[model samples]
Target: MSADEDRDATAATPPELETDRELVAIVAVADNGVIGKDGDMPWHIPADLEHFKETTMDHPVIMGRVTYEGILETLGEPLPGRTTVVLTSRNLETPEGAVVAHGLADALEAAETAAREHHDGADRVFVAGGATVYEQLLPAVDRLIVTEVHREPEGDTFFPDWDRETWTETARDEREGFTFAEYVRS
Candidate 1:
């Protein structure tokens, strides 16, 4: 189907729409498309970390189970200033101060509800991911806040390939180790 036809089909069963809400995907991908290795981020770019924090702060962040566990292991808690919604199928217990959903749609719904309640009118739900979560949500993402790492890093995990033609870069900033680019669906 054409893009408009695909969009029309999606619009038939839309998720609950808040007055001014958007679903944004936030990611940092190396030049070779790697986002993780051995269940963790392959690179250590402090500036990118800070950028991630600032961009997603005060919004609900939806991530996969592995990403949630990785954050807990590395940072010692769910991200501070954001409601975390973890997508998992193992029936594992939800982390303290986090919500769990079995699928992406449920997770997004949960995140939206959390944003409404805790963030006080914040309307962005950030898909802060592992590869699977990113791939699954790519089609529905309204905006992308991507940090494009300069080097190609070898890794087992990769960001899903997306159609560049569907998005238009609206902002860019050059940092030391990476370039941050923001894209809105065109």
Candidate 2:
């Protein structure tokens, strides 16, 4: 199937959209496609951290179990001021203030609902990632707020390769360690 046909088929398979929420993938990827080493981020750029916090601050963040676990390990809780929807098939007890979802549809639903009630009418669901989540949701993402890290560090997990033709770069900012870039699906 062509891109349009494939997209059309998957677009309708969903969490029963009661509202249209922009699905945004928020990530920092190294030049060699590394996004993570083990369960933590490969690099520690404070600016990128701040950037991530600012961009996804008021929106519901949807991430896979591993990603959420990484946050828990480092911060002892979910990021403050955002509803976290943890998507996983396995049963695991989540900490307070975190929403657990067993599937993609449930994850999106939880994010959408949280965005409606908690974020004061925010309409974007940011997809935080551990690789698999980003890979699975790439096709559906409306926009990408990517921090393009300059170094190529070795890593076990990698961000999925996306076609540049599918997105149009809307903005770019050169930072100390990385270039912050935004792309909208075209």
Candidate 3:
């Protein structure tokens, strides 16, 4: 190819790719949507654990630094097929298999890159987080898989608010100690 033709081609922006995969928010909360207490989960629902594992097995899961740390401690690190991105303002490094991002945008960029590199479009990039991370990506997430544990546990963290009119519940099933509900934007 001619140099001028090559230059023009390089300068032109390529058409954007429409991804079928969506950003998902996966959280376990009370009926009131309270998530955490004293930097930890307040409930001991084993069913919720299996549900979380099954849903996020091969996806890119995003979270705040503390949430990432908590998951590593509680769940014994993310599954082998998943990419974990942690958002933080502190100068912290990710563990061997994890990736570190400075903010929500950075995390999303990292997730997109991972999606392209991994070539897994059926899986989503999940924003699984602390309250601030949830609030930041709440408007952009396409699906919410929330496990509602019927309890009045005290919490310093809360889930983002969504209008019932705008979000439709796609699934509602009770398993042992919790009710798993999946919501999709309208």
Candidate 2, 1-186: lDDT as tens digits: 122334432232233433388888899999999999988888899999999999999789989999898899899999898999998888888776689998777888888889888999797999899787887677678888999999999999998878787679999999877899999877
On lDDT, who's better, 1 or 2? 2
Check candidate 3 and list the clashing pairs: none
TM-score winner among the candidates? 2
Candidate 3, residues 1-186, lDDT tens digits: the string is 211332221121122212345878899989878999877888877778778878888678888888888878866865467788888888876665578887556788788877767636646887787887876666677788999898988888988676667778999998766789999876
**What digit string (tens of lDDT, one per residue) describes model 1 on residues 29-83?**
9999999999999999888889899988888899999999999998898998888
Clashing pairs in 2: none
RMSD of each: 4.2, 3.7, 9.8
lDDT of 3 at 147: 92
Between 1 and 2, whose TM-score is larger? 2
Q: Model-by-model lDDT, in order?
A: 0.81, 0.83, 0.75
lDDT of 1 at 43: 90
Candidate 2 runs further than 4 Å off:
1-19
List the lowest-lDDT window of 10 residues for candidate 3: 8-17
Compute each candidate's TM-score over C-alphas: 0.88, 0.89, 0.83
The local lDDT score (0 to 100) that residue 141 gets in candidate 2 is 80
lDDT (Cα, 0-100) at 176 in candidate 2: 78
